[model samples]
Target: MMNNGADLEQCKRLIETSLGWGDAATWTNEDFDTLSDRIFEKTSVRLSISTLKRIWGKVRYDSSPTTATLNALARYAGFEGWRDFMATTQPPAKPSPAHEAPPAPQKSPTRRFITPLIIITITFAVLISFISARIIHPPAANLPLRFDHRATSDELPNSVVFDYDATPMHPKTVMIQQAWDPKRREKVDPYGKQHTSIYYYPGYFRSKLIVDGELKMQSDVFIPTKGWKAIIIGDPLPIYLSAAETTLDSGRLSINAATLQAKTGSPVFNSKWTGFFDVHQFAGISGDHFLLRTTVRNTSTVEQCLCRNVSITVMGKLSAIIFPLTDRGCISDIGLYTGFTGVSGKDHDLSAFGCDFSQWQQIVCAQKDQTLDMWLNGRLIYTKPGNRSIGDIVGIRIGFEGTGEIKEATLQGGGVPQDLLKQP
Candidate 1:
């Protein structure tokens, strides 16, 4: 059996491979942040960016990760837990042959000594040659780089065609990252002029070009939905809802519990979520300074979904603003995320976001200059400073643990008003 250290290392490697994000050495701070978010989304366990960085050796920490952390990592990798992962990773013992071959003769002491000496000399020579070659030919620098993209369509599952010029850095592999998540990165031929990547969801994305492990250039790739789209979040792929499957009437948009159960093929809504997305380019709404007002409530009456959680997300070009709400007693499980920072209820007092979801509740989020404020039921509950600029607001998403309804939604900025329920 492998030691604890070896097993941990193996687990890290498997996570990296499953993520498909190039190499961990080339990952940036934002990559780690994205990793933490993805892990929470899949496991409902939050691992801070600092913790993730330490696990990947990006930070200096003397102690090993806690058991809870290891279990979370294993679950993110599709295992039952750390113990289950270890059981599967252990190598099976090999059986000995019934009739073993007789031993040959032993080598002389002088031959053994000579053999080792010769091998050492050859290894030393090869190491010297490799070092000398690297010194003689260093990587090229300051080449004129160009990266840009064009979306093939204005809908989900849209493929974007990228036009790049990296011929000056030939022989070096180039990477095109679809968004902030490094897992979306893909290698392209250095000599090729174009590359294509498909986006499974609609949102504002920043595409980047990397060469020699350095960022060369980046461009914006915006894929807008044709209209409001409903979906049930699923593993590997989400179950999309047709327009006929949703109810958009009487100035509200909603999905019933039966529809969610039918789409997910599950009776219990423990972690199942249903979302409505209105993704498009909001011309005058800047993510840094805007007001998003919406009336929402959880409609799940299932016994298993006691938390009755719901979240509102404003998708931006650089990052997003996610505000969550839950039943008063389940406040510890909610979290708030601004583009640049995040706060969890487990560590902070987020009781203001807790309320009764049996009736409609109005939530308002406003960002001005460097401050962000949140209000529930027309009462200001949370205020935070140091809000970073996240570029233009491109889309909005509302998610519920099981089922929910949006009575009315509006986004206002730059002296313009947008009705989120109405199509452009």
Candidate 2:
């Protein structure tokens, strides 16, 4: 195929086939958008929705797509680049009917092909009916699923491979959920033996192996003891901070507004704001029995309709306790998950969790057996039963949605509350 006319047409055909478009004329904007998203997920580079539309001939105008865009699509399709894809997958050769001659019959048509044709039709019908029957009456009761997973390494940017047996049930609907994020959910063939995924950050993660929307098996993955890492989310990218950039004053790891602005080149009052602090010395902790004590204060003003919000996450191997703090009137969207059923601000009204966040306030989270309690300034504010292990505590993460200050923090395995009135 030449680059001028037929080559571009061939590229369009390849994209359409890769996207499973039955008919090119019926391709919708949403379909192109899905293609763009899939491409970005597989490769880090994102192609604009408009660029995809033009490539698919959904919109008018175009010089050839830039080399970068072509390379991205090629990488998305598992090739080295646009040139590589073209070199490996050549366009189909067209037939020249004008140069062909009529064939002479060697035998009677009915005698040679009629009997075989009838047999082939019957076999096809039987296969379709068998498939239809399976669809109509799907698997009942859970499949005898055996699931296991292990990581290639127990460090940052680790890859974990999950091995499972769910082939006895519906093979098409088997999926592996890597984390709480919907984007982490991946569909796998039930008949397939294994699936692998990589963890970009360190924490306790509960991975689920699901069959037909039902959880067949669940496991906890803990990436342990990587020291404290701090990050500030810069939308699609994250700005990482070194230990030198942060200070330890008293007992608190200090990250003030000035530090954030200098590192990110932007103020903390922007629409999208995030500051993360993680420590990885919690190998012996569990969500079922642990104590966390901290006092946080936000120096930024709450005058701009946004409260000084700070979140503390005690991450366990299979679950986490998240507390989002804001002003007395703002809402809290905290969560605790053990196999998809735990506490979340969406289901629990957290208006009661709000307080004066501008001043330093004592915060405590503790769990004893199946009971979990939260206390603010020695006053028990929230209590919830049905406490289950989210997983073994691998670490803790403290995040700020705006400019905030950490006065002091401590974690104890268990027992009576540490006296906040007594300075260490």
Candidate 3:
């Protein structure tokens, strides 16, 4: 019989193969970061980069992964959970006939089996006791669990106040998670009635109330941007920019490196990013059938930013459609999300999304009949087939590695054009 350690190793190997990113032994820190994002995207559970490194043996650690982490990994590997994966996994093959060992003389069965029998009896008795206890004291039928949230304002750096009541469950611990990322979770007093969390960015967030690791209730918390907001993406908080700070004239929206440096007080732009967001509900626009046309270009030179990457995101109620454009050499560092699933450039041929950033590039994304088609410079680059509708089109976000410009951004469906750049 294979041990739990061997099963875990097999699970890791399967995940690596599914990722199709070559070998885990050669993966870098950035690779692990990307993996972390992908796992969260798929499993809705965020695993810290350090925790992943330890699991992959990239970091030196003695403790094994927790059950929750194993469950997330199993789910990412297309299984229900760790238990399901173990149940369905096949054991190693027996030795071949030529290598088989000779049988030893059989002895009469004796007290040697008594210890195992006693252990089994004890386990059975414990299970029965647990079942009896559960039957005798069942959970509250009408517990009246309530969870809801309201945003304090309509802009970035917004605070959301959550009202919940998990008292009936009598859980030892209560946690309020801002969104899908568990890193945003915070412990709350079970007896308390309110908790507040600040959202530094605008998006459609699903706030959850968890009682003892079990999700008791959840609600949608949509924090829409006032209009076209520019910001330097930062940790814990972002540097917000006013219309005067970002250049929004002559049918163009952009922020230069100087503006970024002034706002962030930093000159280096290796991993820094700037984003333009219009995160409000677009009336009568369905995410399943819409057209987004934009002209974008990276303004930074190679010396300022090596990758010169740009990403366009169409935020939907359920999921978002995200695609990236980068310099030809940095294509391997990008990924695409088609509202249903995400694919990395490392395993897939995403060369079509790569282009020369010295000139303006036209990008068109259209979703119709549950299928998404991407066009670059009038050339079809990718076609993704989706099953379910991603609900209404909520917002649009344009991001740049260092500095970039959007000449035009328009979304249309049923032949009606909605200028995303217009002030609300």
Identify the candidate with maximal TM-score: 3
Predicted candidate 3, C-alpha RMSD: 10.4
Candidate 3 colliding pairs: none
Query: If both were scored by TM-score, which would come out higher, candidate 1 or candidate 2?
Result: 1
Instruction: Mark the 10 consecutive residues where model 2 has the least summed lDDT.
Output: 333-342
Residues 33-86 of candidate 2 have per-residue lDDT tens digits of: 567656765565789777887877778965878889888877766678888888
Q: Each candidate: what lDDT?
A: 0.82, 0.69, 0.84
Over 83-176, each residue of candidate 3 has an lDDT whose tens digit, in order, gives 8898889676899999998897674566558767889999999999989966764666655788998888875688889889887787788999
Error of 3 at 409 (Å): 0.4
Q: Write the per-residue lDDT of candidate 1 for residues 156-246, one digit (tens) a residue.
A: 7788899998876665778888886666779888889999998877778878897755567889888778778887887778888888777
Residue pairs in steric clash, candidate 2? 317-391, 317-392, 318-390, 318-391, 319-390, 319-391
* Model 1 misplaced stretches (Cα beyond 4 Å): 1-143, 302-304, 414-424
lDDT of candidate 3 at residue 300, scale 0 to 100? 86
Give the candidates in order of lDDT, highest first: 3, 1, 2
The lDDT leader among the candidates is 3
